[model samples]
Target chain A: MANKLVAHMRLPQPISNLLAARNIQTAKDALSIPEFDLMTLLGVDIEDVRDALARISKVASPPYQTALSLLEERLINDASSGRLPTFLKGLDAVLGGGIPFGVLTELVGPSGIGKTQFCLKLSLIAALPMSYGGLDGRVVYIDTESKFSSRRMIEMGRNSFPEIFYSEGMAQEMAGRIIVLHLTSLSEITESLQQMKLRFLQHEVKLLIIDSMAAFVSGDNERSGSMSRDHLLNCPFSFLKSIAEFSCIPIVVTNQVRGHNNDGTSQYSFLGKDTDNNSEKFMNQVPALGIQWAHAVTIRLIFEAHSGQKFIKVAKSPISPPLAFPFTVCSSGIALLSDDGIEMLGQEINVIRSQGFFSIFDAS
Target chain B: MEVSALPISPTNKEKLISAGYTNLASLVIVSPIRLSRELQISVQEASNIIKVTLQCSGAVGLDGRHVVLRGAQTAWEMFSDEQNLKHISTGSEDFDGILGGGIHCGEVTEVGGVPGIGKTQLGIQLGVNVQIPIVYGGLGSKAIYIDTEGSFMPERAYQIAEACIMDTLESFRFHRKGAEDCHERMQPNYFLANILYFRICSYTEQIAVINNLNKIVVEQKDVKIVIIDSISFHFRQDFEDMALRTRVLKELSQTLMKLAKKFTLAVVVMNQVTTKRTDGSFQLTLALGDTWSHSCTNRVILHWDGNDRRAYVEKSPSLPQASASFSVTGKGIRNAISHSKRVRMM
Candidate 1:
């Protein structure tokens, strides 16, 4: 195998001989031991140790891809057209037919306004037969909140696909196609995703749905370190992005929203910025995990609620407009509202702005 | 207890035992830096070995993250288990009532406020209150206090410990009337000594300390609470990259969340507030940006409301959006008035 690490290192003869004596065959083994220790244990010179360590840190990054090549690859890939549709007409229209494949889409909202219901309907759609407009592939749904209800999945199946749910055996087959994994801690979720890279190829999963991302991050546990967040978050989520892009699978993740005020003093972020996701007057609910998290996704949808009315906003998307769509959570699954228009939404925003709620930051 | 039980590579395993660490318990107290020196390996590699061994005594469950196909649980079992998880009191009745008990275990709770508005005081009080004997309606477990701003005063802790001990004794007296008994480890010195304090000087140290806390907890075995006096202190300065700060803070919070659940500890993080420029004025918002607001399971904002200190439960899954008045008295955290009712906001 050419002793991959040694071949890549370009180490001098004495240092390579020293590494051999110490049984340091791989680059990982060399990197795993401190440099000072390398000098004492291997009896190698400081200059050679520095050269080896520097080479390890500076030389080993993934090969860079050009924008043109990526664009060309996507253009010719037939699987790029595999966008599965949600049966709701209004949502399908706003989403430009359906949710696209190979993109990271977020469902952001407050607690319990049918974020899970949206995911359920999507899972059901993704698992449907190709004749019924689905991708005709399996789904991997990672549920961290332990709120994955098989009963609700069956209900959504019966509600959206009448013909498919005709028999108990059919339901069983559909259930088997959708593999639900219950994970609680953040470490567990990230580790499972790492292992799923292998299971993904075997299962031929077309859709990867993490019921909620913010839940596990804040809702679960792990260790700390000198390593920056850039290094930490980049591994799992960007790893996920690569997985989705490589296999042409659409990845869906749900996020929780936190209500905050618009104090322009804070640094502004252009990532996933929707000009009017929430006006300054409506308690200003933004997506959790901040602007840094916004950069990791390709699309962001906000499931908002106000004065008894429900709204699903296309807060961020590469191909969709910055607009809101009214929707309802039915017993079967999530459905769109009967009458939804840009004019009605504009009026609602105007009314919310006119009635000034007491901003309490002044209490300080 | 043997080094043979660690889920590490055989070569590393041989090096570990050769360095005089024959058992798992011996590795618990050995810092990663020392282990690296002793084993002639990198600190990262040393921590890896220690983490593998400390997670479990037997190799049967060494990969404790359990990403593998472990058995699943029903909602009923989760609910029953949650019901039995006890909370560490905030030392105030109204504060405890509005909090659904006190600080919840197996979750991260962030308390934010301007400087000197009792964030440190509340942090110290929780550190003391966690040591209240389990028989006296407390968790009775030790606390790990990571002080970033050097504001954690030992004198304040001693006073709080005194109050906690007195309260335990008083409860013991009341329960003795009911023909019940209490744990004898209720002395003031015992409570003070039980708190493990770490003073962090730099942002990297803060992260490194927290990253290494899992090893410390494995040795201690009874840490019920981990308090970061101010999680945002080091990240707020000299960092030109705003996006980098967000990712770092998010990752750190995720680590704290994982630690809390794995060990069933209440993680309380104190934060300082930054002023946000509003229309022709400035408003005080929690520091580290809006994204930092969602880093905790519950967000409590402490502020000065007409000279009365108030703690607002801004965000919680099970509690209402309410604020209650509490005081940092000479003893510890206590009710501001005889009847400081929960002020429900809409």
Candidate 2:
């Protein structure tokens, strides 16, 4: 809609001819300003350019009225639906009463830091009714790697609520609530996501999970010497962002790590090439995706493993500090460390409620 | 907070005396006695009753003795000061040598790798081997396996266990022993106790499985090994919002760390990887991000060199970083797959 407006500015025919000579397509394209790079080719910097563009970007009078009606409808739906909630026993202290219904929470990690375990347990929790640390809704998982297992889910679920895992009926019931889609390519995900709203409503889905968002670009698309590959790979992420916004359903994306060269020596070294050198030096040699990818994520949690255990650090979160917490991946599920496993697990809800991770959100 | 400060009663004082509190010092040492003493007494009376009043706050350690006056106020203070950390044993002597004995009770460690690279195998190996007592370089508890990938082979666990216990078993009178018997016998000696109490299960029964595990650890007071085959399976399947995904991850990690600490157990985690492609090239990396990277105390990546297995010391909090190559042989985790050369990290 914003791109459609053409009321910005008019350039002289001679200037347009010059822009054409320079291979510029549209008047808007000719604007060479950083904000409007293609414009400079037309040799036009008319005084009213910026204001005219702004005016065109604004919704027209009729569109504004229509937009107001749509906003009203959305607000009403949001209020009435009481969207699914996330239950973090101690995290409410930082998150202010679970994760809000419509936002992304990126659970980042090195390999084996229990990120996937944490994700699995959350799916089980989301299946339970609201009172039992769940949102009582269906969940959809988009597995880029085809690693979803019902047996494991049942195993983890059995102890949390035996009936949910043991009862044969539960398989069907859970199948209805938890959906897993396996895709090998990013195009499939993007195409499917474009129709997510209809599918979600049809499936009664409340949660949408992308096992590794980066894989949609990183894995499915082949990396080559062509610049077009980079743009094509990035297209899926843009579409994912839009999907999350349009559906008002929280989207979770897992990302793979790229070796960073902390030092300048191997800045251009391809993946895994610098392992022969001092790993620390090799890591110092590479860099991450700058600020572009960072700006897209609202929350980012970095997971690491120490001595075969998992720890979570809030690398970037809009609501919490960057504190690291220890974790365990046990038969039950992922859990925060407690003073006493005996006194706290299953025996004391009030005590569990008092922990930092479980405390009531001190919302401002 | 105001009502929390109070005094003791004469009857409570008598109980303290009966519990072996000879003087004010003894009374302070056994703080719970103060609560007993002040049961029905007014705050003023209890406050004025003791010879010297001092506020005892923070963690305390006892002499490892069971004092009858464990109920005393002073003892409570002493309890607050005590810091006890539990640890899990890794089978590798070199790895354990670097890890300051093993995975500590309250710390989180992460193990990462691409699928088919032996992440689960390592975790399973730890489960079978972490059964020796702490003094003997073990935690002496049965292991709990949370298999997320459905690749948790009970047969493999049995194989690992049999290998670990190869030299410990006495010749059986019954020559009828078969694979089932080996499996039954290969299990850690305490397996029965753990099962009788812990009810170790899989991720599908995650909640009940954990509750039983907690029961085993807390009630039996001996469990020490927990293995979650692949932590990513369920979480990746559920939770749409990244923030909520993290919160949930935090909750689970926190719970496990607390349990490991409280019960003196070792926890092992398995991870899955995602492949990243850029400009006609591809690289495989662990799914998830910085939250996971920093939360763990150790990180290891398992990769394959053709048919041979290679493991790297991606990160270890206190240990010097190193990588080793090994093969999945019939015997179990071996230093070398065969006569192949060992590549040591400098």
Candidate 3:
């Protein structure tokens, strides 16, 4: 049985011989020998000893199962798990509760598309206490372009939860919980992600937000041609994915988009005839970092601007169908427009057209 | 005793010493495969030995100050060396004058223009001109022509080479007694033979060619000029993300710059123009945008001025903002004779 278990562990031949020589016949026997003793006596490195120990533990514990089995187990244990509410009623409903944990969620769009505004709103929502539909955990905001604003967060907080913001110290306390890291280069971002395992544990970071992942990865230095840019990009993304899975945190990353060319036809139009055409055109907006990057995300939300109004569409999602909703970004932050509000705005615009007068509009 | 100081067995130490890895530096530079085969050790052990040797020699250090200081002096010496500062002639005297001497060594020179504006013609001329013997006021070095847009015409290169050889032979006849004696050896085929042409279709292949350029340069020791005819072909069309494209382009430029400095080679990169909307008016700009503007040490814009092809010195450290009217004839790029000069000569 000892030999069988030893064979099952699949350790390096040298390490196995050393273990056997030391009369570590079983997994338990190997475990009993201190890590220091294994390193010094066997003349093996710390990494090898750790690997051998891990393999031995795997053999000693319950049998290894497929990812499907583990995922199913997790599903049963926490049926309402993984979903973090975005706090917007219509947006939350479309998202099937909120952004799911253990996966990378990408929010991509062109400039002035409310992508950053949505992210800011999510960051504030993630920092709120459990009673207020938040994760009651810290937020990690990795800003690559230095566009993150604290004043906007304050205003959004004041608008969404006036009571919480009105309580003088509460706003500061909430703001303090969201840890913002301004990383400018791809290498710096990679280094930070590598060291974030410790930071995530220490700060109880539950939400990870990279304001714009495309900015740093696409810098001029990467053009040096020494290393593959695709691989350089894949490193941090894979690291972020692993971190999200291991920490059970929802990693929200934003990406920039370029005008998509379909069969040499201009697909993007500011004002279109039909809603379906607009959404289809918005869907075709090629997300940055290429197709490999597009596949890395579990959910992809695209923000589009049309004729002075903004819309958020579920471009790609695992749990939800593709949905589009009109949203307005104001001093209060990103708020979803109700179906009735859309019609009301249309009527108001018609009235203005009939009156032939330009009146100042209030978004609130 | 020195070999024994390393954490290796006595047998391995004896084997390593027998393999002539007598010192730390020798061990650090030796290939791991050779070390493993000679010492009858694992590849991992050979790698570890090299790592240890490098660590002990302080060649591979964490702080990098030691390496930088050591390299700075060597670089300074190389920089000061007159032989290392030689420039390859661009075949046109006026063009060479605008470029200080010609396409300069140890620097990246970018030629920007629209299609059919004689950019490729100049590139072909430079490729043929770089092969001119050092005795004939040339670098006497080979050229590496990386064609990204399939614009590299060997027939045109032959024409340019024939013209260059004729010019050189004529000049030699005026200067020397027996110039026609060695005319057979200085044929256009010889010039074409010296130019190593690499047709790169994609960005990946272009990068591969740039990365492996050092090996090619070392093997072909006479190669001193590297030309990439249009660097923006694959980059502009295939790239959806501006940042990724910028990074890749930046990396390519850096690699080219390193190659230029290392080999003291003149790197001439051809760039296409794009119409950019600035201040509510469309103006012609370099294809890769403002990010790549600083990548080149010098940028020369070639455009059309009616029937004559004009070259503009858009940006250069040494050269002033200037324009030279040049025409592309059946022979090659030549200074366009002004209307006044033509009348005076007549």
Candidate 4:
């Protein structure tokens, strides 16, 4: 509808040339820019700007929704939303299926509690064939710490779907679909995200995973010290969120746990107690990127490994309580624990919520 | 450790392997002249290969046509590489046990603790212990001890070296039984010669020394374990610009990661702990905040358990979370001798 208007308008030569050069091929693209900024940005005359905006605005009207209508629309949309099920520890059940699409799902955990594994599994799921219960699309896995292992992906592919992945070109085909971009600095990452805007269409991307967002945040922000606190806290994340919404793709970013400070004025110590019920969990540590970040993410899941047991908690969600699932990683990716396995994790919620791991050690 | 893992040209990789230098460990510490002679390649190409391998995370494709290794390897490859990596022992079997063999190369391991939990002792012990011969399940690598706190004492290193020699000789004699052919070539002075110590008095010098490790490592080749005793020492004091500090720290860790990868060396950053009041109680957290925590592949927290000192493997990708009690005996780091296991200390 928007593309049809561009040709039908048959705008002036200079204006069409300018819009063509800017790659504003559709009315949606032209209308995305504000009226005033268009003339300045494109270095065109005010007459050309007005003429262009007049035509483009016809096809792409500004969206104005009443609360009641929005509620109705949301209800219809939410009725049977698509989810990428984790298929582990009955996590999909609590997650309202699997992790819901079209939202920022932050995986918060300390270093090496299988954060990378969880992300890897999801990426594989995103890259799997539709017949195999996958998104059947490409994945953009941005690794900040150079932690993404393609070999492990192959092994997991073989483990999870032995016949499919092992059959001739299946592993190679799957591997080719998941694009891995390993960058360390903030500038480079944001730059990559910018490039990804163009890559989304060409690649048919369904998912974006930043293995660990905190890996380079402090260091990168510190290097470019001139960036304001507002910039530090907002820019990259908001940009990522925009990319998620714009592309209609799920973005899974992992956040590392930072030690909390009571004084709270320290640059990196803004992790507030959000999950009141899990105050004990936050007593010793809080997620990196702090409160603004806490709000930015629509869904959050915490991965904790104590002794030998690994639990994934739905920390912040609209659908479920702060419930945790005891899962383990195997050659076949994260698997649902057996009944005996859950038995071994017996009284885990009560024990963890009440006594906590540190308290137990202290008692011993 | 395979030549394939290096970001060199495939043809050159095949040439090097065909010429009998199969693993990267063989490439390290070897002069370019020998490589040039053996592979029949020009001195320039050989030197370029060595230089590329010596670079942090590395400057790839010294040949200009080749590119740096992409960061997207499979975890299976990492697992296999880790299995082949030579661990520099911390001079205590028990400490080594908790560390999953010892301080692994190609990863940054941060050890933090209070002022006197024998952090310096462990640093020096590792500096000497890394010199353990390759024939004896050791890296046979040199050490770069960047002392930020001026706490790295040469005399203490000498004492530890002497003890190391004694233990090696005693073990050799015990294994040989009645044989009297113990070479006695392992000397404290000889061990001291291999440890390249740099005393960094300020933050600037600390940064400079760490940044220059790549060049130094290229030239020295065999310099495997780089220990920065108390990485937080200079950063904890002085300036008010936490933002600038964070930038500098991040830059430093990035450099360390690169160096660790390119050279397949263990970069030990000994950090000091700070007390933070959270939820009405003070808690001990490693200095430089949570962002710094992700800098290292492994983090071992040295804490005092009652009257005994304990080192906890707080964060590790492979190792289980566990702790082992060790004492700072005159013989360097050893298993904590309590009650039934009491040993005479010098």
Q: How high is each candidate's TM-score?
A: 0.42, 0.38, 0.40, 0.40
| Candidate 1: Cα lDDT at B299 | 90
DockQ of each: 0.01, 0.01, 0.01, 0.01
Candidate 2 on A271-360: residue-level lDDT in tens?
245543544522321112222343345556555543333455554443342345556667767766631111111101100011232122
Better of 1 and 2 by lDDT: 1
Off by over 4 Å in 1: A1-69, A89-97, A217-235, A261-280, A338-364, B1-346
Could you tell me how far off, in angstroms, the CA of residue A172 lies in candidate 1 after the best superposition? 2.4
- Local error of candidate 1 at residue B219 (angstroms): 58
The CA lDDT at B212 in model 4 is: 58
Chain A TM-score for predicted structure 3: 0.68
Which candidate comes out best when scored by lDDT? 4
Q: Give one digit per residue, the lDDT tens place, for model 2 in B1-346.
A: 1112324455655654565654554444434436445455555555444433344322244445544444554555444532355455455544454456656554556676643345656776676665643333345555555643333433345556666666334323244344343445444433322322111122223432442355445655665667765665444432346665565455456666777656656666666654444444445555554575565557766664433455666777556666556544444554543433432211
Docking class of 3: incorrect
Rate residue A358 of model 4 by lDDT: 49
Ranking by lDDT: 4, 1, 3, 2
Backbone clashes under 3 angstroms, per model:
10, 147, 10, 11
Q: Which ten residues in a row have the lowest lDDT in candidate 4 chain A?
A: A343-352
